[model samples]
Every structure is written in C-alpha cells, then in structure tokens.
Target: MVNFKGIGEIIKILNMNYSKKNYAIDVSGRGKATPPPLQHLLDPINKIVHSQRCATVTLPCILKAPLPKNYKVRWSKVEPAEYMEVVILITNGAHHKTYGPLGSRVRLRHSHRYDASLTISNVALEDEGRYRCQLINGLEDESLTLVLELDGVVFPYQTNYGRYKFNYFEAKQACQRQDSRLATYGQLYKAWTEGLDWCNAGWVMEGTVHYPIINSREPCGGRLLLPGVRSYGAKNKSKDRFDAFCFSSAVKGRVYFIRGHLNFKEAIQACQKDRATIAKVGQLYAAWKFSKLDHCDGGWLEDGSVRYPIITPRTGCGGLPDPGVRSFGFPSKLRKKYGVYCFSVK
Candidate 1:
C-alpha cells in the first residue's frame, strides 16, 4: 500500500509540471503576439508631409504630402459650416488664383505627385485660413495645416473693347498713357479680321498732311522747300480748318495725309510747292493704323475728291491763261474755289 501511494504522488507531480509548462507557453505566445514593430510595419507606407496657404488675402489653401507609388493624399476642411466659405480649389498655376466656387472639393490623382506638391489656383478672400492635408494609407490618416493671406493684385492682359475717338494729338497722348502707341497696320489687320472695327475709323499715323514747297528750278520756285521750314508745314486754310502731317510706324518706307478743300491741279501745285505729293492707297495702307474714327459734319480733300487723288504739275489749259482757278477738278472750274493741301514726312 505504501509503494502504490508513493507512485500515485509522483504521477500527480508530473501532471502539475506539465500544466505549468503549458501555461507558460500560452503566456509567451500572447506576449509575443504584440504587432510587428511600428517602424517595420510603417516602412512601406511612411511619407513626408507638408502644407501651405497663399499670403494673399484671397487665396486657397495648398496641401502637400509624400506618398507611396500608388498612395493618394486627400484634402478636407475641419472647420464648421459657417467657416466653409474659406475653401477653394486651385486651377491655374500661372495666375496663382483660385477660380472655382467656394466649398468645392477636387480629387487629385496619384499621378500628379511632383516633389510631393499640389497647387490650387485663384483662392478667394474667405479662403484665407487654415487647411489640412490628409494622407491616406490602408485605413490610417495624417494631416497638416496651411495659412494664407491676401497681398498682391491680379493683373490680366488688356481686353477692353469699345469705340474710342480722339484727334491725332489726343490719340498719341492716349497711347502714351496706356503704355502703347497707335495700332500699327499689322495690328489693324488683326483687329479688322477679328471684327473689332464696330464702324469706328482707326487712326493711322500716316493721315496727317504736311504741306511741302516747290524746288527753286520750278515755275512757282522756292528755295529751301516750304521756305526755310525745318519740318513739314501745318496750314490752316480757314478758321477751324487745320491740316497736319501723319506717318505710319508699320511702313517706314513713306508718309501720307488727307488733302482738304482744293482742286486736283491746285493740290498738285500745293504739294509741289512743299516738295510733297498726293497720297496713294498703297502708301495709305502701309501707314494705316487702328484708331477710333470720329464722325464730323464736313471735311475737305484737296482737289475736291472725296477719294484720294494723284498730284502732278499743271501743264496745259485749253484756252484760259493765268486763271485764278489753277486746279483741275469741277470745283476748280466753279466760281467758288478752295486751296489744295498735301502731306510729307522725313
């Protein structure tokens, strides 16, 4: 009986030792079950994060985050409903302005990551606040803030359209103010094709007529063309009737002008006396520019030709000699005659 009892005791001790060993193994398993080290788990998904807001009073918040090859960064505002007015989407980088409606959300694809930066354009005044960039990996997320302020003015290219009228002198002044001069022929051609005329006459620097003088050998001879005049002449045939000389910047080859109230022959003599001649259409076109044409009651052309006319020396008169009417147009033959004018440029 004693031997049997001792054997039973030994068996009981072995069972207890086995149970303790099992418990230790189970505990070790539970303790070791701790997730892989955070760094090792994050290695494949780790990313650098950054964000920014424009310094301008009206601009959108800009957010940036480093992402894996296929990972994407999502953006959202953490503000309340009333504060939602501050969110905007950027479109164009050149202008650096926000353009979309406020509170509008946009999704950026993973393909757009360049140096881990994403830009929003045309931010508004209310968009001048905090912003968050939410980096999404698996189910985890991280965010950053960008502050913005409004500071600079947005300038666009000139695009105003309307009919503007001004005299030659006034036009020049206007061009100077606008940091541009009268439109050149090429500009006029473009404007015309683009249908910008709107029935307004454009100004060509070539429209001003400077009276010239005849050479000394000519019948109506004068030394120093136009008599000691260093520049072309501005002659007023009558009160309030002033004629000036204009040139075309586009065509540096020649000059042109409109003649007012004169016969063809007298116009020729007048131009000869000044060492200038009547303007031709080609010359007119070469020197033409775009400008607002004014509608005036009445104006005269040399030789009474509403259309431009040619000027040449007076040669033959059928029967009359020394007639005061020395021009070759119907008006010149009439009892009432007007003087001829021409233009010239250096």
Candidate 2:
C-alpha cells in the first residue's frame, strides 16, 4: 500500500502536470487513485480566463466589441429596407467585420488585438439608425451595436414662403420660422433686373417692403424719369390713379403705388403723419410707363412754391378757373386744399 507521504508526493506531481498542461485534473482520497476532480479543477480555470480568450472587436463609432471584420458592412434605412452605402474607416488594426445598413462605403484598417477605430462621412438623414459590428476568431465570436445619426439641411422658401402671400408683417414671421428674413431692396432689385424674379417674388428681408412708412421718396429720384414727361396715370379708368413710386438699383428697377383714395388735403395730412411729402412729377413719371397710362389719371405737379394740375385745360366749373392750364397757384380755390397723395423716403 502506498504510504501517506508517498501518496502526497504523487498528488503533488499530478497537480503540477495539470497546471503546465493547462487542463483540469481530479484526485480521490481512496487507494484506487481515482481520476482527478474534473469539475473542481475547471471552476477556477474557467473563472480566471474564459471571457478573455475570445477575440474582442471595437468600432470607433461603437463603445463595445467582438464585431465582425473583413466582411461587407450593409447599411439600410431603419423604417425602410433601402440599402445605403456609408463611408467608414477603421482606425485600429484589429480585424473586424461590419454588417447590415452600414451606409455607402466601408473602409477597414488593421489594428492591435484590443485597439480599433471607425468613422463615417457624407451622412444622410435616412442613414441615421442602428449599426452593428460582428467579430470572429478561430474559436469565439462577438458583436456590438452602434447608432448613427445624420443631420438634414433645410433651405429657405420650403415653408409658407412659397404657399401663401404675406404682407410685410406676415412675411417677416414666415422668414423667422425658416431662419431667414424677407428679401431686401437690394435683393428685390437684383432679382428683378437680373431676371431672378423668375426665381420668386418675396426676396425682400423681413419687415422690408417697397412701401414702408407710407410717404417716402427714392434717392436719385428724378434721374429715373423719362425726359419731356410731365405726368402719369393709373391702369384702371374708373378708379382714381394713385401716385406711383419707382426704385432703381444697380441690378434692377421696380414700381410701387402709394395707397390711394385720399383727397388732396387728406393726402397732405397722411404724408405729414407719416413724416413724408406729396409725390413729385418726376417721381411719378419714373414709376408710370407712358405706354401703360391709357386708364390712369395724371398726377399734380409741385415745384415746392406752387402746385399745378396735370388735367389739360381744366374745365371751368361755376366760374372756377382751370387749374391745369394755369401756372403755380393759378386756381386760387384749389391751392392748399387740393386733394393729393404723398410719399416718404425715410
């Protein structure tokens, strides 16, 4: 029979052999020399390194790993199965594989066993969603999920700017919502003269209009008018033609009408309240096309010191002289009381 010390020596040798072999062995207390305790030996070995033995994968875009390498990474829309290609670059040398809705393109770089990297570019809104990486080694495999988000670009006029017609105030609100403003005079002029009006009508910036502050004058006002022209008329015959204003820029020119319907006295008061003055002949001419004046009523001409009516040979009514034929202040009764519309440039 084996002695106590002899049996102990045999067990120690068996234990040492098991350690070097990287295997589990069991021993029994009986003289029969039973197989080493398989389960007991394996418990500690499994606990120490089972998880670490498997290959680990990482995505620069992902926080965890065991992702696949050297495989086609497919990217698709979350809601729809449409395939998309996203550009991805791997930073680490570890072999990895990408799969399922990976976007447009996949680029891989070799990395260390534990190190990895990934990147995507030219991302689109639909490209946003979940992405996954799968990794495989001879004996073990792992996988991880990553989320991709793509930002969208929004252009102006996509909102109500195209659908509705907004006055100055309403237009301003619309622009603000779209992160833009109404077109400016410069913009409007550019659009019109440069033929960009074919593009759209509301180019002016918010709170901007050809007719803000009611009565205002244009700079280089008189220069825009046609030579030998004294007056202008409206398009509608039955309706009294209001004074028209013209604005010219290096890019283009536009004509706008002052809101009409006020008598001469009322017009003067309106201009005063708005800090403006009555429209002048040259300004009116600049806005009115003589070819288009068939229905418009001519405007009043004022040279600062005097006012004259454009109506030729003003018919005498109840002994009142014709104001049209006479020079400044000829029609005494029509002097200051003459009804007229005005504009301001400020």
Candidate 3:
C-alpha cells in the first residue's frame, strides 16, 4: 500500500536539482518566476493564510537557492479589484526599508537563512488581499503570491432611501462610507454560521446577491425551506438593486453607552462632554462581535440612527429571539429622544 521507495527517489531528484541550481519554489506552487532561470524550486499546494483582525500573521516565502550577496527581497500588496501593487518593504538580508501605511506594521521575518517571510502586526480589514514576495537579483527575479483573509462579522447595510435602493456600485460606496467593504461569499457564510438571519437580500462581493435565513418564514422565503444562505445568482451590476452586506473587523477604539434622554444634537454634545465622539455603525458592529457588547437602551449613532447591541436576546429588548445589533431606524433629529453611543479613540 505504501510507496516509500518512489517517494524517496522523488525527494532525491529534487535535492539534486536544488544542488545544481536549476529549480525554484514559489509558495503558491504555480511554478517559478521566468527569464532569469530558476535555481531550486519548491511549490506548496496551499498558501492562503487566514487570520483574525488585529492578529499577527506571517506570509511564508522561502528561497532554497544560494542567493547572491546583493539580492533584495521585496514584499507588496496587490489590490483585488484594480490589481494595483503597493510595496510594503524591501530587504537585502541585513539592511531593510519599509514603505506606506502597511510598511509601518510589517517587517521581514528573517528567522533563518532561507526564510524571507513577512510578519504583519495589528492586521486591519484593509490588509485583506493578495501579497506578493519577490526575490530580485539583477536580471533574475522570483516571486510568490499569498492571500490574506480576515475573520470578522458581516452586517446588512442600507441607505436612508430605504431597502433595495442601492445598485452594485452604490452598495460598494455605501460600505466604504461606513468603513467597511462588501462581504465575500465566504465571509457571509461564516456570519451565517455565527447566527446571522436577515430577510432582505443584499449585495455581497463579485456582483452576487445573497441573504441568510435562520428561521425561514413565509415573508423571507418559506417556512418549509431549510435554513441557509440564499442566493439570487449573479445580477446586473448597474440595473439590479439590493441592500449591502458589509464586513467590518475588530476596532481599536472602544464603544460605550452613555444613558441620557437626548435628541440628535444633544446626543452629540453628550458624547463630547465625555471627551469622545458618537460611534459609527461599523464600530458598533465590531464592538458587538468582538467584545460582546450588550445594551438594552437605544443609543443615537453618528449617522442620526438609533441602535443597540444585543448579545443576549431577551423579551424586552426588541422582542427578537436572535442576538444582533437592533436598530430603531433613523429617528427624528428633534423629537425622538434616546441615549448616545460614544467611541473613544485611544
């Protein structure tokens, strides 16, 4: 049943190739960088690394060849939509230089002689994307691509215009305005696993519209249908309209509730008295998901809407069986009275 002899022979051949400097290994296993010739290559099947927000992650990139004395190892992030590459850092074994916002949080992990990996500290949601590690040696260059995925919570977003008013482009802009991005299918699935149930369909990534159904009532879909994420397939990006499912990661600041009977203007003043600003929708969701923030009183958010986080669902709190950030919609700026949620940026 075992083929140890064949496996050993293959390893031996690979080692011989490495010794001869005729091969190379890109972490993605998609093959070696061309033109300048490869020395020793080892391609791993799976290279994607999943990490949570604010957690440290190391993107592996080992070059097995006998590197030149003056070669440089550079790391850059590739934007998913535009394929725009931003250099994070560059090093030549001893001296290193960092660049851009990401550069301040990233450094090369030179643990071993062959290691040319990158270590990112305090990872943020904008850090999710493709990263490229390139080995440059004069006329020869070998590079590998690694994907960084963040584990976070997803929330349905809609404008004041009401439900299903945002087209694909508008939905993307709305999420961005809320300090979030359109959630990916995998991110939505993860949210569903953590008990996300919404009736309205929303735009996810890739021009796809999807919704999660936990209770499965008639208005949502049907009582008989099984509980899962429902999809409307790919829709017209310009014509079809839907809400947006935005994904937000852990926040550095803390969101707290300051109980008071205040309107929109007074609510802002209340937070200012406490030396903090009104919390945004994305910050509230991040606090609820990561810190388990629970409050019963409706609080005025920065967007003029009233909402509250409910980690433990109860009868008096919106009377809903699910645990989520309950919303009271956009209340009157002058008449409706509520508390305020303040965010302190430390």
Candidate 4:
C-alpha cells in the first residue's frame, strides 16, 4: 500500500496479509494488493536502459546525408549509463532546439542497438543542419554531435493553372509535385545571391512574397539600382495567392533531354515511356550547375517553361552570347512544341 503522505512523492507499502511465498504489495491506503517489486516501476534508476548491441562512443558522433522517406539514421551511445532520460538536440546555424514527437518535427525512436538513433520524416529545407543526442544521466550530462547535409537545388515554382494561383499550402503542394518544397527564406536568398533571376514574385516557405533580381532592367527592378532580391514581407497565408519558390535536394538520378518536338503531354509521355519522369526546373538547374550540361536547343522543363542551360558560351545557342539558363516562360500546354527533359533515379 502507498501512504499518501504527500502528492509529489510516492511511498510503497508491502502487504503484511500476503503469505511469505506469495509476493504482494499493498498499493495505496485503499488496501488493495498488487504484484511484488512495484517499487521498481517508480524507481528513477530503472527508467533508462543502456544498449547491449553497440559500444558507447568516447566522443561525440555525427552522421550526415540527404534522407528520403522511410530512411533512418542511427545515433551513438552515451557513456556513464546513469542518466534519467535521453534527449535529441537539433541545431541549425541560427539556434539550438530539442526534438520530440509532441511539438517538434522530429521523432525519437528510443531504441538502441549498436547505439541510439533518431528518425525524421518529410524532411524540408528548414530541417537540414546540425544535431546531437544528449544523455541526462544523474550528476553528469554527455552528448554526441552530428551534421546532416542535403545536396539539392533551389528554384522558383508556379502552378500549371497560372501565376499567383497558389495559397501557402497549395504552393508547398505544387513544389512537392515537382519533387521539391517551398524554398526557405535562406534558400531563396542563396539562389538570388547566386544569380537566379526571375521577374515574377513567388511565395516562399515563410508565407512571404519575393523574387530574385539580377542585372535588374526596367522590367525587373531597375538597371539603375544595384540588383538584389525584392520582397513583400508577411502576407496573409490563407487568403493570398502567389507562385512558389522551391528547393530540392539532388536525387540519385540521371537527367537527360528527350528527342523530337512534342507538346507538353507528349513530352511527359515520352519520358514515362522511357521509365523516367519529366524533370523539374530545379532538377534542370542542378544538372546544369553540377554536371555542366549544355544543350543548344531549348526544351520543356517540368514547369511548362521551355528553357536551356548554356555552360560554355558560344555562337548559335539561343543567339545569346552569355552562358546561362534561358527561359521561355510558361507556354500553352496544348500548343507549345518543344523537347522535354526527363529524370531517372538510380
């Protein structure tokens, strides 16, 4: 029986009425008998268990990679197994925060083999950065650090229906359709600083409106002003409609251009026929930036834009002297005739 001396602390009482051979506990002043060793259930020392399979790390450990759905990263074990609880900590360049399933985006497995592990789902640009798991053992705190890197590209995105047609949620969904997500402010700024020039404003991850400007002409911001990213901060997320600025990690895949002049539907079908999906604008950008791929002919990217990337500046390519990604804006899906780019994951 437990004596209710106070509410904060629990006092266990053994049942004197029970036989010597039979182990029983009096659970509370109610006079009810329960199993033996009830004291261990509330024992602070018994709360945490050490992993038997893996050796504990002497120093902090790190695991870094781009993770897709259903992928898991194993965590390291902590020394001095005298802690009350284990906590997983995540830190970006800006701040440090704890991770839990209740309020945070990350979920802790609480399982340990060789070591402990943390698992995450629906990983976004905001989710990438640094992480560490801490053991809050009695009288001592220990931790191991990890760095997660996502290798992907960032670009602007808009719905096929039209420009400024998506709300914040819809914008994210549209990016997902293109194998991407609404770009974070940092990501959009990175793209802009890297010379991603677009005339149209788009919805970024923070529900704000922005656009990258480079060599700002009258149509953009202005040739007179120093080229930079323009912004419309903190608009109504639910009511406002806009395009999306998206970011995508590099996939383990190959991107190639399909042959023949085909309309949008036909272009998509050609890729499907070859067991590939039509490449997204960000994927195209990634291919160009990372692979140095150059094609003389402008082709259809996933966003319905006919564009081509030129790595080596030469004559006869779009009749442009500069080496860059040239765009043909969003064209009519039924009437536009152009080749399409396709991506296949290995």
Candidate 5:
C-alpha cells in the first residue's frame, strides 16, 4: 500500500488493516516538495536497482504531508510462508534494535529534505527478499514495497543420466534435484564473462540449450572456431534431450568438505554428526566463487555427483589454464566413493 499527498499539505485518508504482526517501525520527516503519485514513484525505484551493480540498495518510502514526529517507517520480511511467524521489528531510526538471522547495518534518516530512505550495509545473499516499508499515520496506513536481488556464480551440470539425457523439463528437474535452478541466459552469459567454460551443451532457464567454450577445440566446437557461448536456440520442452546449466545464488551459511571419502547416504549422516547437512551444488559453487573455496579432489555434492572447484587449475585438477567447477558427471552413489561437502548455518 502507498500514501499520496497533494501539494500544500493535502491529507488523503487511507483505510487499510494496520496489523502489527511483529515488525519494526522507523519514523522520518521530509519537508514540503511537489511529490508525485505512488505509482509514478515505483517505476524509478526499479530502474535505480536494475540499472547498475550495487552492493547495497537504497529504497525511499514516501509519506503524505510533512512527516509527523510520531509517524514512523517500518520494515519486515517474510518467506516460505511457513516461517511467517518469525517476522521481527528491526529498528525505528533512533532506537535501533537487531532482529532475524542475518544482521546488516540498517540506517534511516528523518531529515527535513528528501523522502525517508532506508539503507542496509554489507548486504549478503540472504538479504534478497521483499521488504515492506510502511508509514504510520494512525488509521490511514500507507506503505511501499522494496525488492532485492543477488549477485552470484553459475555452473553447468549433467545428471547421472549423462549428456543429452534431459529435455527442457527434465533439465529443469535435474537442476532442482541438485538444489539449484536452471540458469537464465543472463546468468549463463555472466558466467561466461566470469571464466566459466564447458564443452557439453546444456539447458538453461530460457527454454534454450547452450554451452560456453572459452577455448575452442575439435571436441568443443571446432578447432578453427573462436571461443564464445554456443546456443541451440529454443528446443521442444519434452522431446529434446540435453544437459543442464544450473545457477547458484549466494547463501548465508558456511560449507565445509567432510574428511574421508563418503558416498551419498553416508555424506548426509556425516554432516548430521557435525551439526550440518550435505551441501547443495549451489552452496559449493557459492563457497568457491565468493568464499574462495578451492578443492582438488572430486567430492560428492548434494546431488550425488563428484565435482571440485579449481580456482587455480593445474595438472590433474581439471583444466590447466581455465578456472572452473569441474564435474565427473553424476557418478554412482552407492558404488563410487568420494568425499562429501556439508553446509550449516550455525
């Protein structure tokens, strides 16, 4: 919900359910200005976020009239719906307080100038979500919405079924099985720009099959072909069989490689013994890309594949010149033995 005020201190009455279902509220006062409609204000907010790469996002929530000294700015987050019960009151400008699992520096200014804005510093992957910024006007409840996105790495995947075994839908399901989603074209291109190289063609989020060849060769594309992301365009969702390119977003928890080679089932038990769970493919990729996790041996990911991240490739470690998350495809879970990666929040 949004509140609109006309020029010269006009008051528009808003009647919405102002349920304080456990959230924090902050107050700000911005002096008189020719304010635009709530709808007009939202478009600019989206442009500001999407236009550039940002570590921190600044969002402004508008209020009618000179902000009341008692008027407040409120913030809350909800996800999975089942965890809705954990909504918390983070802060109220002056009387700052902490809430939720991941904590960042949230600041608010009630200056007598521009509209009230909230800033969260040192943003993390878990910070990506829908945040409600509401204005406290007694019965006339007004609010605005703020959305955050993550910046992370993407890796291509192949199920135990091997290359070209998946159609578009099966490719998507394969990524989900590995605790990942099908990579968007944008995500794949970003990975290409960040030095991701693979020879096998795979399915991405755009209902298309593609592959990146950093160094063209006879097996990859062609010996004379230049390096680039090759595309198979849009293929039939069910008929086409191909591998999958999966995307992993940054996560809040930590990932560790469990000592000793363990198969799929044993991997889960190993992590549980250490107060953790088997690390997903995404978690491992995030740890590799962001946390600089470098492992030489191919270990068991949550999807039961043997893989390793070689940030600095060398002999016997996948590629020699290229840095990537190398895969042994999806190996036999019960027959093959490999170390397992685990993840834990605490």
Candidate 6:
C-alpha cells in the first residue's frame, strides 16, 4: 500500500504558486552532462516499470541530496524518437503544478522528504510509454527515463476489407478505432505463451507480420515448423498488407447487449437511447476476458461488425468449441439486423 501520511505535504506543495517568471528553469539543455548516477539522485538499474490497468504505478526517483531547495523536479512523457514530450508535473521543493491527461492522474509519491518519485493512479492504455523525470538545479540538471508497460491481452484484428488488406498505417488506425494498439512482439509472445493460436499472420509493433500457433497443423505453415510464432520478417510499412495483433488492457466500463433487430444506424441509436455508446471491439474483448461476459446471440459492435463472446462454448453457438469472441465479419449496414452491444462508462 502507498503511504498517505504526506497528504498535507502534497496539498501544500501543489498549492504553492511557482510561476514561470519566478521559477524559469530550462530542462532541455544538457550541455556536457555527466552520465548518471546523477550527483543529486540515483535511478534503478532496470528502468522499466510494469503494472496492470486501473492500478497505480510509481516511477522511482531517489534523491541523494538532503532535501535540496531551489531545485525543481519535472516529469514529462517522452514521445517516440524524443521528438516531443508532455509535461506531467513540476515541483520546485515548495511549488508544484500538473499538466496534461497524465498530470491529472499523477502526484508525487513523497513517501518521505527525500523521495521525489511520481505516482500515477487509474492507469490507462494511453499511459503506456516512455517518461522522463528530471531534476533541475542550475548547471547540475540531470534526468532519468523509464518505460511504463501494462500487462494485457492480445487479439488478432482485421477489417471488412478482408485479410491481408491493411498496410502498417491503416492497421494501426484500425486497432486504435477498436480501443487497442498494435501489439509488440513481446506482447504477442506473452499471449502465445498463454495459448493464443491463430493461423493468419498479423502485424506486430516491429513492422513485421507474424502469427502464433499452438498446434502443429498441415494448413498453417505446413506443420514443418514447431508450434511457435511464425514470422514473415520485416516488410514495407506502406506496401505490405496483413492483419493486426492488437493489445488492450482492462475496461473501466460495462459492456452489455441491447436486444433489438437493428441495422448499423439503428444499433447506434439503440445504444444512444440507453445513454451509452456502441461497444468497441476492444471493449467487448476486455469485457469478455475480465468480466467473463458470455452471450450466445450475435450483437452489432461499434465497427459495424457482428460478434458475440462465449465463455462456455457449446453446440450451435458459432458451431465451434472455443471460448472466444465469434465474429461474423462486416455486414450490410442498412440490410442486416442484429442486437447491439452498448458500452456504459459508469
């Protein structure tokens, strides 16, 4: 459990106003900076912090100095390739301020006077990325970078355009539309270890197409290769076409079926009538995995595709013996009628 004795200290720190005119500190300039073990702080050997969704995660920043004053600790989310960053918080010993979405959920751990660590609550998928914690004290400014990874589930995704129809960019956009992101090789491997068996190759984060196989089959890879993730190697992001393995974490909302014989437009209206919205593909997957949502009847998802989650497989339910989401591909928007899955963010 996190120590909350410093609540008054946190309120006191964040309440103090330290405007730019009074506390103008440049964190970008690292001229001739010595490699860490910074003189003021020390970081962990492995800077990767892993946690689950909706959990609190701490990015450690141990201070070596004795409650140093006139020094500000700045935390920012570093973008890929270091091209951009969004500030999360900044505190100059007394004054503190927060910024951006992450900032709204972040606070200084402040377990002790010497602890300058940052804690983020209600962690979400968007918070998975690189973050930098910097200590600015005149020319002695130094920083440390940490990567936040969430343990989650991975599923293969494809659009109505059919298999092998999406390029890298389009595949990513499709995953985002479904409330997920392109799964990295590590995430895919983790899913494979937990019994993810698929025959079709899909796009991973490294711009490669691969598929996880648990059973050796004649149709998939000729049964010659052992049961593992078969790879197609790296391909052109713009030219190569394939399905995608999307990664998603836990859901904070409820996904339920709104029984109705409705088209795509009607499905949308049905969800809106319930004061909710159509459930995204990823949200449905999360609900099935985390909440054990099981339904035999096919329902319209947000992407105009009909699907159903079956936790206890039986006869006549998609006619298969797998406990997973059964998809019917993308059907006609105006002609098809099905029950709609609505997501209520409560």
Best TM-score among the predictions, by candidate number = 3
Q: What is the lDDT of residue 197 in candidate 1?
A: 16
Clashes per candidate, residues 3 or more apart or on different chains: 39, 55, 7, 10, 2, 0
Residue-wise lDDT of candidate 4 within 1-346, one digit each (tens)?
A: 1123432222111122133325433222224434334210121222222211011212123322221223233222211111112234433322345534312544444333222345554444434433434332332233333444455566776665668898888888888777667777777787777668888889886678998887778987778867778898878888998888887765556788887879889989999999999987767776776677798777887778888888887887767655677777778888656888898877
Per-residue C-alpha lDDT of model 6 across residues 1-346, encoded as one tens digit per residue: 1122343432222222233213322222322223434567777787889986788999898888564568888887755322356678998866689987777899999887778899999998878877778888765576676779897889999888788889999989999999988998888998999889999899987688899999989989877779999989999999989999999888889999988789999999999999999999999988988889999888999888999999999998988766889998898988566899999996
lDDT of 6: 0.81
Better of 1 and 4 by lDDT: 4
| Residue 98 in model 3: lDDT | 96
- Model 4 C-alpha RMSD vs. true structure (Å) is 16.4
230: Cα error in model 4, Å: 2.3
Ten residues in sequence with the least summed lDDT for candidate 1:
151-160
Q: In model 4, which runs have C-alpha deviations exceeding 4 angstroms?
A: 1-132, 138-151, 221-225, 319-322
Q: TM-scores across all candidates? A: 0.21, 0.20, 0.79, 0.59, 0.61, 0.78
Worst-scoring 10-residue span by lDDT in model 6: 24-33
User: Mind sharing the TM-score for model 4?
Assistant: 0.59
All models, RMSD in angstroms: 32.5, 32.2, 8.9, 16.4, 10.4, 9.6
| Model 1: lDDT of residue 78 | 25
lDDT of every model, 2 decimals: 0.31, 0.31, 0.81, 0.59, 0.64, 0.81
Candidate 6 regions exceeding 4 Å error are: 1-39, 42-48, 52-56, 65-70, 80-87, 97-101, 136-144, 319-321, 334-337
Q: Compose the digit string of candidate 3's lDDT tens values, residues 35-121.
A: 234453234456689887778999888877667768888888754334245778888888899999888998878898788889999
lDDT of 1 at 293: 18
